[model samples]
Target: MTYDILIIGGGINGCAIAREASLLGLKVMLVERDDLAGHTSSASTKLIHGGLRYLEYYDFKLVAEALRERERLVKAAPHIIRPMQFVLPHENAVRPWWMVRIGLYLYDFLGGKMSLPRSRGLRKSDTLYAAPLKHGGSGFVYSDAFVDDSRLTVLNAIDAADNGADVAVGVAVESARREGGIWRATLSDWRTVEARAIVNAAGPWVHQMLGSLGVNASSNVRLVKGSHIVVPKLFEGSHSYILQQPDRRIVFAIPYQGDFTEIGTTDVPVDAPEDARIDDDEIAYLCEAVNRHFTTQITTADVTSTWSGVRPLYDDGASEAKAVTRDYVLELDANGPALLSIFGGKITTARHLAEEAMEKLAPSMGFRAHPVSRARVFPGGAIADFDTFHAQVVATWPFLGEARSLRMAHAYGQMLAEMLGGITDEAALGPNLGGGVTEVEARWLHDREWARTADDVLKRRSKVGLHLSAAETAAFEARWNAMFPREPSYA
Candidate 1:
């Protein structure tokens, strides 16, 4: 059957576009070769910030747009997207204290009206947030946000599906050819599907998809590799630390997963998109970056988990990988059937990018220009405020422990009720799949969230993988396979 729009790529951008198009009353089909957010989307810094560092690059417009979206995301999905404060310690040698303060001031101003608190200056010796730093001169605390990056992508896909879009995972578009004024795309399984327009939001593979359609596009995509490492907790507070490096590039040491600290992101160029694995040198670089700032030193041996992703940045003729623009560029080809290609977008600005992309395709697809609902909450994200919602969740499920209840509230939001209804206590929820992950949650993920593998449930859907033992992880995998024996193994 022909669809009004066929979105290629299951990353955050494609899913966001799918949700927007479907809500705007267009028939949309999103097909992914792997799980939703199986790559770059899941490998973000997990922050919904305005890219404060981008101020140095004179990217005020991008920063302002992202700041606006950050607020929207926090309100739309209070469960998954919540406010966070980042502590930026001043170093005497690097950027001046006045410059840091000025940047923070501009960032706050760009944010406009916000639910989060404004940025503020802090004394070095006064607060515990400054205690870990090496001779903290003066520091600034600024508002940003954190997110369950993979879950956000999945929620967008879920929202799209709910709005009558067909979302298919582990499916590929092998080829596409324009025939009789319609673009006919052939899937890997030798099936053909026609669409009025094709959106190439394929992240790193956007150029390759365009090539398959025999469209010669001039926009070059530079593949930049970013890698992160997780270690034992360093700081005491819920607030995160943004440390300046000798190289002028900054690394974030964020409080992660309750027990660990997340530090990362080294920008390096790679030949292919799949070359996202962190090397020994990259791991050492991250550990050294952390050791430079915090009193708590961490070596490679102390590392718990590491992830790497290739950013499909638009080639803007920059001299360095880190210098590439984070802003997205949409290329709409109106020659035959409409083809909208996206490049260089961050998770924070995905929704806005989708809205803009839909506007570009709407004229060709014969759909309304505006999305039906932009502010609708994502699946399980109906909570108005996170704290109030969590209090209600704990009050309703009094049997749940504080830690477990909070985890559930963060993972499922208001949908935790549906997940826990008619079931009381941990026993009725079935066997503990290690950590707080129960058989009930796993089944809900499998049936509702399109979780196809053990990693999908343990790592992407939730961070239970970090809490599980090797034996427990194996057991969880066994149970998962038994539950869905017919599902194709992805890895």
Candidate 2:
């Protein structure tokens, strides 16, 4: 049977589009060449906030749009996304005190009824936010949010599947042609499928996907590589620090996991998506950035793990990669069967982009989508209050202990009970394969969440790989492979 929509790419944007279209009563199917969020979606700074730095670039609209989405997402998925405090110290800063203050004030004003607390002034001597600072002065404290970026993408896919969409991971499109007003496509699985419309949200490879279809784009994709580094905890506070570099760029120092600090991201221009890998120079740049603000200094030796992803930004004629617009553009070519290609968007605005994409394709689809509320809750996101729900999870599974229960509550939310399979004892949870990897949880991810490989389970589904030794990681990989055989996917 021919589907109403076939979306390419499994990043946040693609998954979000699938979720939106599927929920709007369309027969939607999304195909991904790799695991969901296997690329840039999983390699983000993991924050859900209006880009405060974008204010300097005069992207007021983008910031406001993101702030609105931030409010909606926090209400819809409280477990995976939560508010966090950021301390912006103004010591030898590039922007003047008054300019910074006005920028933040404008930011708050633009937010306009956003539920988060407004930004406030903070003195460098204030111990609450200044104890770890290397210099003394005044700055500001503001509220944003943190997120499990990979899981956010996964949650969207799960919601789409729950709403009757076919989500195919590790599936590639080998070729496609327009015939009789229908898109006849062959996928990596050697199966031919038909769709009335196709949405190309292929991220960095979006242009490549278009080229293969013999379609040409009017605009080009600017590939910018963003890199991040993880190290031992820098400070004892839960609040993150926004460090202003001498080059007028900003770097973030965030508290990560339980024992590490996550800092990054360098805006280096790259030619290809596959060129995304953190370099020693990038590592030194991030270290130097944070060192300017923190009393505790670190170098490459202190680094634990690192990640890099190439952002596919629109070629907006910006002179620098950092200056590119985060706004997305949708190109719908409908001379034949409807074909839409998405260019340049961030995770924070993906949901809205999906909504706009649906509207763009409505005429081509022969019906407009009366989409559900933007705040519609994702799968496992029904809990009203996360802290209260967390306590209940600990109570339900006493064997998981406080820390493990808290982690599980955040990861699975209301679905933790389903994952536990009504088991009440530790023995029922199975063995700790490595770093809290249990036979039960791994099986659930494999069966329910489309975890194809151990890497998908270890790195993306959960960051347990970060907590394991080299030997233990290898052992867990062997065990995972023994549990599920690898599927054959085309190149």
Candidate 3:
């Protein structure tokens, strides 16, 4: 059976596109090379921000679009996305105070002000009194949103499936050819499938997909690898800090996972996309940046976890990789049935990108363009008020501790009801999977959400891997494999 649209990648972009297209009465199939969001999507800095620094690059339109989308995501999925405060310490040398004020003013007005609070000024003394910083300086407090990037991608795929789209994880598209005015595609898993229109949303591997189709890509994407490090909690507040390095690049020290602190993101260009990894130099760079402003001295040993992701940036001939555009570029080849290729996009603007892509494809697909935007809600996002939802969840599972119930409700949203099944107490949650992960959550992932391996459950579906010890991970893997054996183990 040929699908109306076949999306390659299964990252946020592909999943978002599939969800929207499927909801619009299109037969869509999304194929992922590995586990969903195994690469760049899961490796993001995990913030759904408007890219306040993009103001420096004169990307007003991009910033405005992202700002709008950020609020939309927070409202739609209050369980996974929440508003976050960021403190930007002002240094006299970085930029003039008036210029900073002007940028913040534009940022506040750009999104049309809904739930997010507007940016506010702060004196060095007053700011430090509330949330103490290591190196004292005047600061400005602004608002942004944080997201569970891995879970968000998975939820999109789940929602697409619920809407009648065929979502395939652990499946790779080997070739895509245009024949008889339709796309003839071969996917590699245990078998292959064919489709009509092919979407190359393969993120970093997009160029390779174009090459396999014998199509010459006009726009080249520069793969830049960004790395992050996690350490023990450094600050006491829910607010995150944006630190300025001597080199002018900024690093974020954000409160993470209730107890840990997440610091990151060094942009280094790479020759090969798959070669993206955290090197010693990059680790040192991140540590040095954090040490420059933080009160607590963090060393290499303080680094509990490290991760890396490759950004598929549209090359603009910029000397600095960090300066490359975060805005997405859509390329459509109108040779036959059309192939829509996505270049650079952030997690915040994924839904907007999908809407824009669908508008471009509508003409070729012989359908009149409709203003069908997915701005309302995604699956598991039916909660109108978070406080009421939290109260209900806690009330229902009185046996489970408040923290655990809150975590599950926040992580799964209305889907948490389905995951809990008829369980009434903590005992029914099954054996502790270490960290806060329970066996019930693992079963939910395996049975419903396409989680096949222990790593898929621990690393992606839940972050138990980060909090678990080596011995605990080994025990959990043994238990997981014994419960559900795979014919071919995930490599």
Residues 1-491, candidate 1: write the lDDT tens digits. 99989999999999999999888888899999888999999999999999999998999999999999988898889898878888887763388888888988899899999889999888545578878877764778888999999999999998999889999887899889888678999887567899989999899999988998899777889999999999989879898988888888999998899999999899999999989899999999889888887777888999999999999999999999888999989998888888899988999999999999988877776766875545777888877678898899888877777998998899889888888998766688887767777788889998888888888888899888888889989998888888877555332
Error of 1 at 66 (Å): 0.3
Per residue, candidate 3 scores C-alpha lDDT tens digits across 158-250 of 888988999877778777688877888776764555666788999999898898889988999999999999999887878888776777788
lDDT of 2: 0.90
Q: Candidate 3 — worst ten consecutive residues by lDDT sum?
A: 123-132
Among all candidates shown, the one with the greatest TM-score: 2
Candidate 2 has its poorest 10 consecutive residues by lDDT at 123-132
Per-model lDDT: 0.88, 0.90, 0.84
**Which scores better on TM-score, 1 or 2?**
2
TM-score list, all predictions: 0.96, 0.98, 0.96
User: Comparing candidate 2 with candidate 3, which one achieves the higher lDDT?
Assistant: 2
Q: Which candidate, 1 or 3, would have the higher TM-score against the true structure?
A: 1
lDDT of 2 by residue, 109-153 (tens): 988998888998995356867888887547898999999999999
Model 3 ranges with Cα > 4 A deviation: 123-131, 489-491
